[model samples]
Target: MTKVDFYLLTSHQPQIRERFACKLTEKAYRLGHRVHIQVEDQSQAQKMDDLLWTFRQGSFVPHALMDTEGAAETPVLIGYEGEPGAGMELLINLCREVPQFFSHFPRVAEIIDQDENNRHAGRQRYRDYRDQGCSLETHQLSI
Candidate 1:
């Protein structure tokens, strides 16, 4: 069964999700996990790709866009649609809705903001995962 972790943020700041995602992906990479970040669209994926490079001072994460060459060999991959390449261990989902392919991965991370829209969507995703009988957990993030 897939393990879904919902990270609920206390701050409602815009774009916080992406920033946190960068940090999360970076940590996962450092731990030697292949991470694939799924966003709403290509533009969001581009934003994530850029943020991963400069989200913090002197941060370096080896990553590539999902559609790019040799993405399967990269430690992290960002994509807007479709399934990720082979050997993907963790998935960081930034989309409003749960991806249809969520259960395929061993672990799925959902980042949620405090705003009404995000909270509502997060609840829906939680319910969806619960219905599927997957192992679900929620954490409150101070940031």
Candidate 2:
């Protein structure tokens, strides 16, 4: 069984989301877990990359622009492209659509409830995934 975590955040700021995702990824990495992130936009993806570089100066996190070509085999797969399949353990999803890529992973963490529709959708997703026997943990952020 895989551990899944969900967070309801009050802040709509891009920095807050980026920071939270990075922090979570760092924690996961420290615990010997692989981290996978998918940002909504190119700008957000760049911000995440920048944050990663800043956190570990000169260190590189594997990044590939999502498109029809698909993502190469790697630990951290960013962008909206590529098929979500085996080998993915931990996932940090920022996209509103909730890509089908994360379906196989039992452990999926995300920040939801940024808006009205999202609030409802997020809650529904939580319930649906939980009903499927996925271990779910939700945290509300002060942001």
Candidate 3:
């Protein structure tokens, strides 16, 4: 069964969730887990790709956009549209709804910041995952 983790952030800052996503991806990469970050569109994917490189000073997380070249060779992928490639162990979903290919991964991370829209969508995603029989967990985060 796939495991779903919801990280509820106390801070409502718009960028906090994206920053946290970068941190999570970096940790997963260091731990040898291939990660696929699911976004809503090409713009979002580009945003994540740029943020991952500049999220933290001196921090480096090797990644590539799924539609771009070198993505197959990269452990971390930023995906907007289309199917998530094979061999990815974790899915960090930035999309409002769960991606159709979510079940293919062993683990999924849903980041929810304190924004009303995000919280509402996150709740829906939580319920959707639970109803699907995924192993669900929620964590209240201070950030």
Candidate 4:
């Protein structure tokens, strides 16, 4: 069974969620886990790829877009579609709905900021995961 974690942020700003995703990916990568960030589309995927590079000062998280060459060799990958390569241990979902391939990973992270629409979607995803019998947890983030 996949372990699902919902990270709730206090602010509704979209950028906060992206930054948090980058931080989470960095932590996972440092801990020797392969992370695949699932965004909503190509545009969001590109944005996340850019954000991961400059999200923090004096910070570096090696990452590549899913379609690019050498993506398989990278510890962190960003994509909006297709299956991630084997050995991917974590899936960070930025999509509005649950990803079809989420269960393939050992851990799945869903980031939810304080936007009304986001909250509603998050609640639905939470319920869906619970209904599917996945182990679920929630973290209230002050940032």
Best by lDDT: 3
| Regions of candidate 2 where Cα sits further than 4 Å from its true position | 10-14, 55-74, 113-118
Give lDDT for model 3.
0.94
Q: After superposition, how far is residue 87 of candidate 3 from its true place, in Å?
A: 0.3
Q: Which digits, one per residue and each the tens of the lDDT, describe model 1 over residues 69-111?
A: 9887898999887888778999999999988888789999999
TM-score per candidate, in order?
0.96, 0.70, 0.98, 0.97
2 or 4, greater by TM-score: 4
Name the regions of candidate 4 deviating beyond 4 angstroms: none
Worst 10 residues of 2 by lDDT: 63-72
lDDT of 4 by residue, 1-143 (tens): 99999999998665998999999998998899999999999999989988998999988889999979999899999999888988999999999999988889999999999888989999999999998889999999999
- Note the Cα lDDT for every prediction shown: 0.90, 0.69, 0.94, 0.92
* Local accuracy of candidate 2 as per-residue lDDT tens digits, 12-126: 7755666777777767766766667877777877777778766555555554444425455555656655655567678888776555656667678877747777677777777
Compare candidates 3 and 4 on TM-score and give the better one. Answer: 3
Would you list the rank order by lDDT, best first? 3, 4, 1, 2
After superposition on all CA atoms, how large is the RMSD of candidate 1?
A: 0.9
**Model 3 lDDT-worst window of ten:** 77-86
- Candidate 4 local Cα displacement, residue 18, angstroms: 0.4
